[model samples]
Target chain A: MAELTCQQCQELAAELALDVLPGRDRAEALAHLDGCAGCRETVAALTATADRLVELLPGAEPSAGFEQRVMTALAPPPPPRARRWRVAVAAAGLAIVLATGGWMLGRASHDLPQPETDAQADVRTVMFAPLTTENRQIGEAYVYPGQPSWVYLALDIDNDTDVPSSTVRCELVRRDGSTVPVGTVPIAKGYRGWGGPAAVDRETLATARLINSNGHTVATAHFRHTRRR
Target chain B: MRGVHLRRRPPERLPDDMLLAGLGAGDAQLALAFVRRFQRTVFGVALAVVGDSGLAEDIAQQAFERAWRHAGLYDPRRGSVQTWLTSIVRHLAVDAVRVRRPAPVDPQDLMSLIATITDTPERRVLAGETSTELRTALAALPPEQARAVVMAAVHGMTAVEIADLEGIPVGTAKSRIRAAMAKLHAALPTPRADHG
Candidate 1:
């Protein structure tokens, strides 16, 4: 991973705050954060904002029996009882199952005390952006973050409207509105095709578009979160 | 006079923190109250990310169980019980999808979340927030940027995930997230000179 300068660290602070900066970059940024106060403060403020974003999603009701199910799941095990003759007879049959695969052992494990689940457990986030032409959905982008985190694109461009190319250039628009070439993907028989790894860069991207062999934009997908207030 | 009148309030009507305290102490009624109070919000959060009602239900249950177990450790300074529980369920739901289905949700599907949800006083209470400064700042942002920031902030998605999900390059994803967050952070109230 390239070592991040203070400027770069500050630039990626939001990713770090949101825990989405990709692997080595994340490690590099955290190292920079340890030595840099301004960056830490910047990241902290973003973290606060990120935390507040949860309020935007509205709550909805679960199934009717959910409450009973939750309470029943939380119930403690019944006390182990002293055996009467009939109980002892039933227990002997149960002992056979316990000895074979140890079903009772599994049940016993739950009886033990458990450590409190951390409120701040590590969570992986996924994003899906649709590809469109003239406001018509044509395909989608599937993304996951990790070491060299990945993106896969599935495009089914309608040639009748999209001016499909034998091959299409996948171009991404940057934060500065400059366009970067990812690569070209071929259409074997028709416009329907898919390409992967999609060359997700380290810089922030604004939009993605497909350019035809004629250098004309055919389909574009603008990634926007339109969560209403 | 306020104190005299308050004593008549039902256990179900107790304040959030008090209910949380009761939950931590394993008070059956209070625990039930806590579950009832936040179940919808918790279930909604779970369902939003996973997009599966059954999986969402399991996640919601686990979230409530976690809340019941960890209520004592909760910090009011961090957020209200509702927000905290939402956070828990959101993480759980994300984790569930990562394990059950790694594919990204449709951008339209996510956009529909805002459109489909209605604003209500109940939602505000569930959010455990009255001050709209942060939300206002988020709203002030361009639609694309706000969505990027929300995907990162609420869903715990990274720039790579956003890049992949948006079918954009990683740089563009990072830039959108950074720019959005910076704008939102700028909107936060500045603290006093007592800064640590």
Candidate 2:
């Protein structure tokens, strides 16, 4: 195909900026943009320009419970091991309590901040869905905004897995498909593992996953980092 | 004692940008503040496009969720939080309209549109000077040009849809939108690097 001239690129710039370019034209414009820095800048400025029209219409308030609904929709699914883990953890606590014969019934030292409250407190939840059926592990990462490095991750393993703590690994997946090892996630309270406030920043982090010593992924989930300020 | 002045304390509330930054960081209080700050604009634009309070509510909800999820991606250099968010709500609202084929644009809607533009509290508090310039520039456009652009923008109309609405040729509709964009850009001031 012949190289597109600046004029052709400019003509399509306005339409593309408005997101109204026909598919064929859009494809052609993108092809040109791959090689044209000037056109890219023009498109960006024009897009900003087109977006300004939004300010003209008056602001209106939506009905209540809308935020609640959105948050609920975005909530991470219950961990795969939750059902079994709940029973095992409770039973184990009871057994330890009965044997020791000293501690209070509800007092276990492994108490982490409940994520429901964490979410209510405005900590962003970075949910990772299972990448495959074999990898039944799910993850919910909590981080205070602007402090991406200070991530608190909860990894839920499948009820059947028995990987030793010495071999477990957790990683932060990035948009470019690279992985950064954050730390190990041990089997805490039977199939539930927690790790991090890892030194990893949220800038490129896309997914958080668990891996076994065998180099196989145990569970993986994706994250959407929309706020970049 | 009469001549002594007390030092002023820092204001307790975060500015819009800081609140958004906090929301990006997953601060719940700031998230609520951000919603309180921009919900009206988000919902209003959605309402104008979708023409139903309920559907607009859905669109607005999705828009805010998107803002929260993608807060880290927002660039202050590009536009203010208000303008960037306005774009998101407008696109979602327009998409909602496309999907449902909601009520056709009534002439009275334009009168109401004018009223909203004139009376919005957000326009004064949230919108920066360029937004004001944009409003004036849009007003200065020939009525047909302004209408054509609005139809394309808030309604997500194509050149053909705009042509059908105005009883004009597709090329004419396209040029009117293009011309309006040009005029608006010319009339507005350059975006400030410092403002969010």
Candidate 3:
């Protein structure tokens, strides 16, 4: 409750004159200035200085064609209506691939079996106990490549489901028919299921599967690696 | 001849909002309007700060080009369009001043101009007397302190910015400004002299 020193008042004076103090600090400085004579004097001096500076350095206006240049950089592309049907057709094709999980296998090729209808393979859907009282929903699958023959599998959650607090196991099947259990991840209420990537060569992994702690199949997908064109 | 006639029109009289909207729509005419509107103010502030017509012209051109590229970011909520635009010009002019290191008195021409046209006889007499006293007091200060005070008092730079530009500590900059103010306060004519 002691009087604030001149230095503290000075700092506040400078900051207030510049309009740079945070809200709470500004309020406190103003409250202090209300009763402090020295601080009030300091504020007047600073204001006078600011006014004089403004007078001394009157501003110049900008040049011609300035807005045109700025507008040129900021202008949006022409409306999509000009090419509406073409864009719509492309979007519809992308929607089909996403809905059937056909694109998932294409991305996870190394973990999928090469079937006769390889391009048309559908991901196997397994129903687990309702993830919530509401219902179960499927999420997108993601595959991330890592060094020295490892790939991460991430299944994005599609709904706010109350998943049971438990662990889920994943298995990877090799092209030569050998199988190996991978890591487990917790399936808490808000958790997204991920298996720590299994260390298997690209030539070996042909299929991947997930099962809950109760031994019920939750999801399955095949993988096939394609040669680059 | 057509181009010359078009060039002579004042930019501020143009419909700036329409041009700004056009700019938002990605049209080139907005840039043309923007250049015409602010060119003079930018050049004027630059000349005032740098005190050299040539440097002012160059700085004004650079500042305008930058404002053009960044125009889309302007928000009407904070300040008027002119205020925001002129703030850019002011900062760019200050930069020119820092870089050129021109003699401080050279730029005092603008101040001298302000001193010349007195609105009233009394004001004229007072401004003339104070201007002489102010100059004498300013000349007595150390060059660094004088520059710091002048930049702060004349250009509205914060003490921190002055310190950064001058390569000194904030405390030193603040003290310099305070000392310069004290010197000027002492040199100011007594209140009795005004009554006489």
Candidate 4:
């Protein structure tokens, strides 16, 4: 039989000591050890070494309350019946519009005043400006105006890294008595897409506030008419 | 007759996949049974890797919980249940080690203390003479090498996994394991002592 190289024997020794070799490799290594006294001695030493080290490990058992604690942590909370009913009613109402094809897909486009030059117009392009609080930058608030009665408020968030995918509530508050919900912005890419047509009663036309699903004011804009026409 | 006898006989032990299947069925009793069977060994491995009793307990519980949750993912073809569970505990321990900064105890002092404490006849006898010698040898090794051996033997991690966890090259991890093993081999009692 050819002698096993030191490296080959060492690798086998490590594998045998760790008991990590696959069945075939284990068989081959054992075969080699059977005829080779040196290799056999090496394997025996390694095994003894492993066996001894195994005993020094701490033998502390899990506490008696472990299972109960784990179960409690994993247990699902009871359903909120009242809340579910409200949601069911709201869903039923939505189902009607969806069923009847009453879903509105209206789009209103308004061109802002042209800049003095093409460069200025290009520079005047709207981009999300981040809202900063407590020295932590939270999100970018979208700023654009479409009509006097309506404001387009958009927040580009990376939902993947930012928001937890829980139910989020969005609301638009006008300075006047009128308040309207644009709709819940599905958090995508960490940003909340909000702002659609909101009917601002003439009485409450002083200012508008965009509140996110968390009820925090993400952005606010003052009412100033660019053209009275 | 021999072939007939072999065909009729039940396998000596149930496979890990079957055990895990029993666990996943919400068989709390089977789960308890499994825990009872492996708890000491698993805890021992965790304790060896982290070198802390409290951390070992946490690691054991977390490893079991993870096993419970992902039991369905266990494949019998890959390895035994013992190996799989060991791998999980070791991976978690390695991660814990990386995230945790050890207190400023001098490695040499700690090693010396371990050597002295484990050197007693009673301790040696309790662990078996071979184990005592092994522990002493391990304690005498460079901290990194000793850590590598402990992580492999107790936690059941591959050299690659240990290197990745420790942020060292694979070759470095292998060398540490080999060096630690060599030191342990040299430290064993003479063959005469073993026979007697």
Candidate 5:
């Protein structure tokens, strides 16, 4: 096809910027634009103004729960294991100064901060464990002891299948088999990353199991019982 | 004063890019804040284009989801978070309206929009200086040009489609759109980098 002349291109700039120019004319104008600087400048300025036009629309509040709904549609989270792996590989690569020990385990320890910082405070660090399904690891759970206690969760939704919208339940099981609910979190795509502010009795949590929305246990992180250690 | 200590700002206080990062990383609180910050603007754009509240809501919701999904790709150098998001919601809204087919844009709706933007102080504030200039310029245009530009820009109507809607020749439709855009372009405080 013959390229559009500069006059033709300039005439089409407004429609091109608006993105309403017909396909053939658009192609010709763009072909002309590739070689013509002046036409390009005109098109660019017009395009910017067209986009800024949307900003001028008056805002209107939608019905309530829209925020909640949008949250439910959040991006796929980076799984706890994935996050640890990232920190691990990054640490291992950066562990040049500390190569006296196994780079792997030392980097893995970075996942837990201040394990012995406040031992006399009566807070326990019963588990900083990875949650795994029957076939492979999918998430990680942290049951760090504190005044109230805290739980951190990282889960990948695609253990063997893709179920990003599945809501995963985190429960801390006690010695008596009674369980405390950490919280129900929605996973998008394959990963979820959440930090601890969940107030629970860390000393009492004997096991951490991730249950899918269907009430079936999907992954479990066996707590390293303090006595067993 | 001795016991006072610095603390991290709340999620609501974080800049737009930070919230978007949190949204991409799937931090629930940040995701909620991101939604809260832009929900009304997204919904309004969607509603204006589609002119159906129910469908607009769906498109708005989908817009958020898409933004979350692709938030990783956002670049600050291209535009502000609001501009990036406005483009997303606008595209989604335009696509939704297009699917409804043969969209006969009401001149009244476009006129009402112009009136709303120029008359409402909050809307002007939301738009900022450059956008406010464009809004005022839009409000100042001849009614035919205002309707023509809006139909093409917001609804993604071609000149032929607009001509059909207004019972005018395609050349007349193009002239109106071109004239309105030239005026709006002149109103911009500074020529912005093109996003398209």
Candidate 6:
């Protein structure tokens, strides 16, 4: 095996500080740094230099409400046991009410043949930014209260439309107006295609918005949830 | 009112280390101060990487929250509060950028930032004497090498991405960045231990 020299170590150390070292070289460079104090100091100095360069970029003030958002995210998690207790109590009360209503209805309509159960599943679709006759937005989501939900979204664009090469990102907007990033897909700028089949975990679905790389809202669709009767 | 007056002490301004410690202890006011002190740098780094203000805001928020949560683990011996916080912001921003391809940044973008800094206190400090030194050092490098280093440092562009942007070969791009860093390391003063 060829012994790694000091010059080679210095070169790799620079790459390590920049974070552009190919993964294949990372192990060898790290092994060198493990035993070499001088190289370690050099890497640290380079890292410090790289960090100061961050000061050069023009600063952008965060939008209004950004501080509030950070504070909210850092707030302590609410007591889940209490929430669960409340939900259990509500479910029990609902069951009792349904039983009583069934008993009352049976007594009143014994002669009437039992009505056919409404077995149809409700599916909802929404459209956002129906800009032109040729361009439209359509989406559908299936959600069950306690399980992960799946979604599908599509955007229609006029063939003549000119869009720069862009990627699509989708967010799951909950009823309370909070959002969770669901997924992202890359496609041609003007290419019309479906955005997801993304699985959503937390937060009840309220809407999904497709956004471009420039943060433009290409289209949005509202979701309506219905409980089985 | 009398009890409140008796209990109140003047809000003594603490140094950055104390403020960081307070943030770790969940001192809300200190957390706010920390955020205010560093938000510009955090937001600036995020904007440089993602190139979208809204997305940059999200990344900055995450960076601050992460810093606060992990403040207990911060060891001043390793680096300064600013250095530690900058690392957090850079990590988040780079991850955000690497996961997706953002709009390509033009070299001309550097000129816009080079415009004489004004408005914010932080920028004033950045534009002050230290930046002059940094600018001089940057000027000493070949223009192509300087641009490549800036692209790597600011935007967290890898060698391959720099090659694509600069229309150079990947091997050449990598060498340029490595060579640039060596020159910069030689040029800049070793950051003071005070930064730790």
Best by TM-score: 5
The lowest-lDDT stretch of 10 consecutive residues in candidate 3 chain B is: B1-10
- Candidate 5: tens digits of C-alpha lDDT, residues A1-229: 9977887887899998877787799889989989988788888778778878877776788988776666765533423432343433333333332232221111122222322211221122224666677746665565544333456665545444534365668787887899887887666644445543454554466778778767888778777754321
Model 6 TM-score (B-chain only):
0.79
Candidate 1 fraction of reference contacts recovered: 0.36
Q: TM-score for all predictions?
A: 0.57, 0.59, 0.35, 0.35, 0.60, 0.57
Model 1, residue B12: displacement in angstroms?
2.2
Local distance difference test values of all predictions, in order = 0.60, 0.60, 0.48, 0.50, 0.67, 0.58
Give candidate 3's error at residue B148 in angstroms.
8.2
Point to the candidate with the largest DockQ: 5
Ranking by DockQ: 5, 2, 1, 6, 4, 3
What DockQ, on C-alphas, does every prediction get?
A: 0.13, 0.16, 0.06, 0.08, 0.17, 0.11
Candidate 6 — which pairs collide? none
Q: Compared to the true structure, candidate 6 yields what TM-score?
A: 0.57
TM-score of 1: 0.57
Clashes (N, CA, C under 3 Å) per candidate = 15, 23, 33, 10, 2, 0
Looking at candidate 6, what is the lDDT of residue B83? 66
Task: Please state the error at residue B178 of candidate 4 in Å.
Answer: 3.2
- Give iRMSD, candidate 5: 17.1
Write the residue-wise lDDT of candidate 4 on B117-167 in tens digits: 345568557856545666566657787887677566655566766677778
Worst 10 residues of 1 chain A by lDDT: A116-125
Give lDDT for model 5.
0.67
